[model samples]
Target: MIVTRFAPSPTGRLHLGHAYSAILAHDFARRQGGRFLLRIEDIDGTRSRPEHVKTIIADLAWLGLSWDGDVVHQSQRLSAYAGALDRLREMGLLYRCYCTRAEIAAASLSAPHGAEPIYPGTCRVLTRQNAERPHCWRLDMARATAIAGPLTWQDHGRTIVADPLTAGDVVLARKDAPASYHLAVTVDDAWQGVTDVVRGQDLFAATHVHRLLQALLGLPTPAYHHHRLLTGPDGVRLAKRHGAPALAALREGGSNGLALATELRVGRVPIGATDT
Candidate 1:
């Protein structure tokens, strides 16, 4: 059976963009008589609010979408993530990264303007470490890629070659969180037996890293559908940081959620929404 999931972080309330993604996953599963799972990516304990999780469930239900079985929370799956990290560590594909954000930014100055900062692998060669010093774990990208060999994954109908090197050596475990987004999401999807991953196009690049992780960890690679993002009046994608209105706000303000969901299904977004 086809199994898809909508995994959202509980750092903020669900907005229209979230509703669109959730509805797409839910509808796709229902159409195929598959299971739609809901997962709360709450690994970031510092920022993940329990209240936001409740609101997220409420917002999805308000939009007339439902999921099968119980909702999975990443916070409750630390041991699994740890096991994945341990396997990588045993294979010598993991290293401790002690560079701070500011230091990493300075090192990545030669990168193209407006591009994401790529780590220069300063810690990859570190022969000594202070047990007292706090450090995050980074994947030895070169070694990992060498071991995994060439890899590819299905995106929509296209077979995309995995290029995790573009992301440099990514952090797998951090001091603030037990597992990074790349590590947790990749592990969780496999553990949940997700056959399809329906998310926004913003994460399309991250799939490269996920593909590599799946190969290294001997997990299944799910089909991916990176749908276009919904934009606001300013053309910026709808996000909490972009000041997009929350679904709860719209729902409480007398907007008919069912009607909104129906319109979204036909690509008729709300006011100020622009297709990307």
Candidate 2:
């Protein structure tokens, strides 16, 4: 059966943007006669809160989005992530990176525009003994990119492809954290049997890295649909920083679930338009 998921980091309440994504996933799954699943991306233990998770679940339920199975939490799957990292290590596709955030910031500032501080492969040459240092673990960008080749994944109305070698090595797991977003997301999507990824356009660039991870790890690459992101009246992306209203807040304001659904479907329908 076709499977899709709406994975959300429980760092904040489910805002309208989230609602649009979740509803899209739910509706798509239903249309395909497939299963829609929910996954809690609470890998960031520092900022993810139990309350936020609970609120996200409650809000999705209120929005009439139901799932077939229990929600999966990324934090509970550290060993799986470690296993993937170990496989890459055995293939000599992983190295240690000791650069601190400040150093990376300085390097980026020194680099020319359109060029992200392409990791200089500083730690890629570390000796086996040095690689054992607690602060090490970097991707072998050269090997990964070569293996990944020129790959493409589908997105809403467009196709995004990348050259693995040029995409740069991304951190899979940090010395302080067991799994980074890229690593965890790739694993979760594969394990959950997600056949399609429906998310915002803002993440289009990250798909390149995700595709690379899939290639390195031998996981199935899901079709990606990066839909338009919701924006506030100011034309900026809706975010908690700008106080973009959340679904729970709308619920608390006495808007029923159906009304909220209409709000989510607002822009697509012209004024005085009727549903056939």
TM-score of every prediction relative to native: 0.96, 0.88
Writing each residue's lDDT as its tens digit, candidate 1 over 1-276 gives 999999999998888889989999999889999999999999998999999999999889889898999999999999999999999999999998889988999988666887778999999999997757889999999999999999999889899999999889999999789999999999999999999999999999999999999999999999999999987666678887777788988877778889889988876577633321
Residue pairs with backbone overlap in model 2:
95-138, 96-137, 145-164, 145-165
Worst 10 residues of 2 by lDDT: 267-276
- Which 10 consecutive positions of candidate 1 have the poorest summed lDDT? 267-276
Q: Give model 1's TM-score versus the native structure.
A: 0.96
Error of 1 at 248 (Å): 1.0
* Winner by TM-score: 1
Which tens-of-lDDT digit does each residue in 1-276 have in candidate 2?
A: 878899999888877778888888887788999999999998788889999998998888887789989999999999999999999889888867888766776665445675556666656676655555577477887787876677777776467766555546678888777888888999999999999988888777778888888987889988888878877655676666666677777777666766566666653322211111
Task: Estimate every model's Cα lDDT from 0 to 1.
Answer: 0.91, 0.78
- TM-score, candidate 2, is 0.88
Regions of model 2 farther than 4 Å from truth: 110-118, 128-136, 157-159, 165-167, 266-276
